[model samples]
Target: MSTRLRIALDAMGGDHAPDMVVDGADIARERCPNVDFLFVGDEQRINALLDARPALKAISQVRHTADVVAMDAKPSVALRSGRGSSMRLAIDAVASGEAASVVSAGNTGALMAMAKFVLKTLPGIDRPAIASMLPTMRGDCVMLDLGANLECDADNLVQFAVLGTVFAQTVLGLLEPTIGLLNVGSEEQKGHEAIRTAASALRATPLARNFHGFVEGTDIAAGTVDVVVTDGFTGNVALKTAEGTGKLFGEFLRRTFQSSLLAKLGYLLARTAFNKLRQRMDPRRYNGAMFLGLQGVCVKSHGGTDGLGFANAICVAVDLVQHGFNEKIRKELALLQESLQAASAAASGSDPQAVAQ
Candidate 1:
């Protein structure tokens, strides 16, 4: 077993493959000196790019494989035929204990399907969630089930809350992260039975102090809670809406700046402020989406993102490994199970099956 912290990279998974992947590895190497990389893809192509960056070459190894997963491949097709592809092999490294985690900029569905099939879920988690950090008025907030499960039950929602809370504490470094269930409104009767049941269950748990009733769509940007939990369908729609809104706002600003000579002059004077805002809103800054509740760390980067964005994704994988994220999640989950079991026993006369149900 290797003593060094090794990350498996799907070198041919992105839009601007091999080159973008190699360049991103170089940048990540600079930021995380203690980390090493296992580049899994076409050896010749990867080496051709790495040859120029001897510094990156020293800390990385190229595992030769000619197969590559197509960006448009369906999850079922990819799983059935892409066994030797870069994405699948990279994930295999984590399962075989050759790497601490896997990072890929590939088809989201394929990646998730392969990861779940290979790595499986953690002890107390039934389904894994896709989670990412979102910029907010207060600071960065964690949101989960970005597009993992189309439909989720009350128990699934509760599990997502636990996952998001652990992520905030591990990566975001929040002491007691506040959690809220995304809903149509803040009122107790706003959503369906599942959301209400999940909310009620959370309120009864030991983590009740951190639960903040319910939150609406506006609350996501307002940073009403440190962690937001919801089913993947709703979460995915919300994420796309936010992205669209940001792009629309940027276009509006651009048009305003070019409207008149006076506007141009104002832009010149306020260039510094605009640049700061751009940096903060840069999508690359938040490229990594984690597959929470998995037994191993698996981060998915945007396929169209550039080297800088890919580097941020690698950083996310490294941070999770260094922080022992999975272990902490397991510990927190055990506590939640015990709390739930005790409550169920007290209410239903020692029926363990009641808690499971």
Candidate 2:
């Protein structure tokens, strides 16, 4: 009968299925003892796993669901016919106020579509964005629109900047985080019209104080800015390229260490350093990608991740909900709107069309 922070999980959505979901809940339970869970998936399989973890089972409830969204299923197909799916049911729990948020290691495209459809976008937010933090030498940096809207106008980019700012503040604990537009070059005259327009628009707002202008791909790793804003097509490519680079370097190190006996000896001498490097580069630490701008909190876990990764995703959801992320975004955006309106009134005698300039 205890009122706890509840999270809904799509128990059958991951590559590992009910086992991974149940195990993750167990791990997440240790980190977040106050949280309860609503697991939406095959009741029989889920219960069997839960029965083994009495502690997790004590705080969990299972809602039977047989339908599942395929990993490779088209977003359009899933959206039209995935109503009874575990992914959909879990999301529905959040929309109905039965859960504070939903976490799933499911199909990302389907999750985004269903979440936007069910929870709707926040007022003034035309589209939701996929945002997550990445490790940088200076610390972690937040980036957004990572595969959500491939094509974005100046307004959409501006909205992304707003969303990224709130995300960095609430999640990254950055005060007045610096914002930058991802571009081919750092020059003001570089990039396309949309980027140029967005940059000009940002300069007119209070965010201008922290806006750092255009940032190239290298700036992302250099931590030149706290938030990197780009269209989904560009952001997605950057994310994938970074991931691939990490893997390539890791492979190179492994091969180098095994190439000769002297190399093996050297690796042994530097084993502790290597272990630290491995931990620092671990992908599980950054497994959660939040679907920002939705009315409800929903986090997408990497489908290939193990229990630890999924648990991290659950923790991400917990952080967003606990910090009242959506409320903070609404408050920040309202203030931004008011500031724009005031500026418009002063500049053009309240000509609304002039504000877009």
In angstroms, give how far residue 301 of model 1 lies from its true place.
0.3
Candidate 2, 191: how far from true, in Å? 0.5
Q: Report the C-alpha lDDT of model 1 over 1-357, residue by residue, as the tens digit.
A: 545799999999989998888889899998987889999999998999999999999999989899988999999999999999999999999999999999999999999999999999999999999999999999999999999999999999999999999999989999999999999999998999999999999987877999998999999999999999999999999998998999999999999999999999999999999999999999999899999999999999999999999999999999999999999999999999998978878787866766579
* Shift in Å, residue 35, candidate 1: 0.6
Writing each residue's lDDT as its tens digit, candidate 2 over 105-141 gives 9999999999999999999899999998999989999
- Roughly what TM-score does model 1 have, to 2 decimal places? 0.97
Q: Each candidate's TM vs. the true structure?
A: 0.97, 0.96
Query: How high is the lDDT of residue 157 in model 1?
Result: 96
Error of 2 at 317 (Å): 0.3
Q: How accurate locally is residue 184 in candidate 1, as Cα lDDT from 0 to 100?
A: 93
Could you list the CA RMSD of all candidates, in the order they appear? 2.8, 2.7
- Candidate 2 stretches with Cα past 4 Å from truth are 1-3, 350-357
- Report the Cα lDDT for candidate 2: 0.94
Least accurate stretch of 10 residues (summed lDDT) in model 2? 347-356
